[model samples]
Target: MKILFVNNGLAGGGVEKLLNDMLPLINESGNYCELLILFDDDAKYLESLRNNGVKVQIVPKKIYNKGHFQRILYIMNYIKNNDFDIVHANEFPLIYYCSIIKTILGKKMPKLVMTEHNTDNRRRHIKLSRPLEKLIYRNYDKVTSISDKVQEVLLDWLRPNDRDKYVVVYNGIAAENFRNSKPYERSDLVPEISEKDKLLCVIGSLTEQKNYFLC
Candidate 1:
């Protein structure tokens, strides 16, 4: 199957890392997978993805600089020309654009899939956006979330009757890298602690959604 993964940009974020890890595996499984990103700013994983043989396409700078509407047109045109089997959108605005494209193209559009990465977003906080979000989500063939909590929150917010459309696909990591690496001695990194000292580690982006303050 020919798949096109769309996102806003390739910044150093969890979503970007997820795509960098996932696209290569998808292509290796006898399927054609390509990425369509809106911008090229601070694309930390761009080289890594290309090295792994995942085709990464970026919107032309001219079109991207014009405005949001122009970028949406470019995306629509690109999708129309690519003849992809599945267009999986990973983030906002692009998700909205892809949803709108599916709506406009109707049956002609490819199987539209979106991955909801966060349990909460600004759209959910806006009362007027709820109906619009429901309409946008309804156009998707499948809606996947990175965690059960994300899926639960999304379903509760959208209140869509077709509950089966939402699914939880947990984020994955390349565990072998951690397993194969040498373990670090606690004293080597932080000499202040002894063997008896209790320690806690938190790994995630320092975003409000992560709720680091709760720790």
Candidate 2:
């Protein structure tokens, strides 16, 4: 299938990491995967995707918000010009755009899919004072959550009656990449730490969802 994976940007995040993991499998299976991202950045993730034969495009954004109409137009036009079987949105903003396109264009639109990467995020605070979230989500061909907990959280918010529209799809890890990673000394981060003392470490974005407070 010719799938266009849509996300906000090529940042070192869970969503980008998941795509990096899946690109090899997708390419090996003879399925083409393209990337559509908003904003331009000098991220190495772009080179990785290009090296794996994934086409990447930078869609211009006039506003910082994900649900901006200008970005929606760019996405709509790109899909309309391309022959894609699926348009998979990896974030809430892209999901909302795809949903709108599917709802408006119907049969003319590509198969819309969305993946919810986090159980709790900023999307819940959309104070648009509208009741069209469920209606928008219904337009998607399929909705996936990274885990069962994420699915439960999404369903509780969307309140979709069919229930079957949502599914659990665990994110994959690129195990081989870690095999040759250079180990860092604990003293590099902590001047008071001794080399003999074992230290606990945490990785990933230090956001609220990461729950660093628990540690």
Each candidate structure's TM-score, on Cα atoms with residue i matched to residue i, is 0.94, 0.84
Worst 10 residues of 2 by lDDT: 122-131
Q: Write the per-residue lDDT of candidate 1 for residues 1-215, one digit (tens) a residue.
A: 99999998888988999899888888889999999999999999999999999989999999999988898889888989988999999888888999888877888899999999988888888999999999999999999998989998999999999999899999998787688798778987789998899777777876787888787
Which regions of candidate 2 deviate over 4 angstroms?
Answer: 60-67, 126-130, 178-192, 195-198
Best candidate, TM-score-wise? 1
| Model 2 root mean square deviation, Cα atoms | 3.1
Q: lDDT tens digits, residues 116-172, model 2?
A: 888776656784512577777888889988889989988888778879878998887
Clashing pairs in 2: none
Backbone clash pairs for candidate 1 read none
